[model samples]
Target: MGLSRRQLRLLMVSGFSLFLMYIMYSSKGDNPSSLSDSRESANSIISANPNAKIDEAINNKISKLYQQEQAEKAAEEKAAVDAAAGIKVTEEIDAIEEDFDPVKELMQIRALAPMIVFSKSYCPYSKRLKKLLTEHYEITPSFFPVELDKHKHGKLLQEHLAKISGRATVPNVLIGTSNESKGGCDDFLNLHESGKLATMLNEWGNKKLSVKRLETPSNV
Candidate 1:
């Protein structure tokens, strides 16, 4: 029998709802497969570029190694520099300790004699002066010879002598007193050649005696 209009309308509405539900279910099922296919395509693309991951890993490892090597090298250089600095400081300290006082020694030597010869044993000029003073002159008692190379305060004395006399060599002849007269080998030779050395020595000797007399008390 033919349905009434209301029943036909209700039947049509139910059919349409069922059709919509089936279509939504089908779409849901297709979405998962589509996503899986997309994932597979991405994987295939990555696989085609096989060296990409390897290159990245290699670069990272090499970079890390390079940084480590640089750090080690820097540390070694710093250690070397520190060691060298330490050695230099130690040497400087040793030099300071070994240095001598020149002024005090010079004063003491000057008091010892009026005619002082600052000489080195091995120097030719010093030998010449010594020979001339000892052999040619009779001034042994007043002649004072200082062998600079053998003396403990030699270097200091030499430096001080250089500052005072503007000469930094051996065979430095000092006459009368420490600061009174200064001459080198050439001056000594000149005096000897001119036959004035003996006269000069006699004069200085008499001068020393006069100085002593002046210093002595009148009653004594």
Candidate 2:
């Protein structure tokens, strides 16, 4: 028997609905299995490859090395900055030293007299030494008195004196042609008391006199 058109249409609709449900069910079932199969395949590959962990370890080591290299580069840059700053500071100090060269001033003073007395104007010890030398010994022209505090390069001179003489105090009495005498007030007083000061002055005076006599033209 032949079906009616409405009944045939209803049957076709039911069949189409069943087909859609089956498709949905098949998609849901296939997605999970496909995901599981992919996971299992990945696991099998990892198990077969013995060096998977070693590759991971090598990647981790490379990452660590990159980090260490970055850290070392930062340290080197910091050290370079510190070194540049140190050099600038050193240059500034050298410039100051050159500006106030005490040695040059000392040489100029030495040229004036072999016997030099480094002193300060207001110092009592300096006054005492000056009086002793000028009044008692009468060694005026050959005796050179440098008032350090009054001089332009006084501070630098003091620094140099401290280094050379091992004493930076006033009334630094330097005597003889060799300029060997390096002492303070006490040394001067001791020399005076011992009468060595008189003897030294006489000897120095005789040498000067002889030199003058030699310089004078002979009666030809």
Candidate 3:
């Protein structure tokens, strides 16, 4: 067919517009042909290897077994670690028990003097009792003071003291060689006010153990 010049010019303009659109699409990375080629290649590979399906099943089974084996190994390792930790803890406890005897320790502390004051440094009542004993009275034998908070085995001592004395709180005042606790700070105050402390000290001692009251400032 013989085309007119105007028709040929219009056809060239349309062809140039189409080419521009294709260049824009290519720059934007749209590739349907590449996707189709990948699918064809995969199909060709599968067809060439007829036992591809069977091989895939065997690979999946092997992977699953490997995962289960790794999981079992991890579990066993965790159990072994926990057992070792438990054993170490048990051994440490046994060592402490072998080294420390609360009963024996308490007995030795009690035998320090005729009178012992098991106290905590921070307690208000313990402080008051200690002040009165140390500052006010002078006996033949000075009273022994044990600050429980300062002791390494303080908790064990306090527990054992509670069992023996039936009192858990501090400023635990005990008297005589038998470790007799008349009571804590409040009880001692009552005894001091009643003039019983002086008399008791004299009577309980091997010799005449006088609790000589010291002269101090009247304001104190």
Residue 98's lDDT in candidate 2: 80
Give the best candidate by TM-score.
3
lDDT of 2 at 54: 43
Q: Best candidate per lDDT, number?
A: 3
Q: What value of lDDT does candidate 1 attain over all alpha carbons?
A: 0.69
Quantify all predictions' global Cα lDDT against the true fold.
0.69, 0.67, 0.73
Could you tell me every candidate's TM-score relative to the true structure? 0.50, 0.47, 0.55
Give the TM-score ranking, best first. 3, 1, 2
lDDT of 3 by residue, 92-155 (tens): 9778867888889977886777778899999999998888777878876788889999998788
Q: Give the alpha carbon lDDT tens digit for every residue of 1-220 in model 2.
A: 8996556745655565566445433433335457777677667656655355445545565566567668888999999999999999999877877887677777777777657889999999899877766555545455778999998668788778777766778888665544444577787677677657566555654454111112222221
Compare candidates 1 and 2 on TM-score and give the better one.
1
Clashes of each: 0, 0, 0
In terms of TM-score, how similar is model 1 to the real structure? 0.50
Give the residue spans of candidate 1 off by over 4 A: 1-99, 178-181, 209-220
> Mind sharing the TM-score for model 3?
0.55
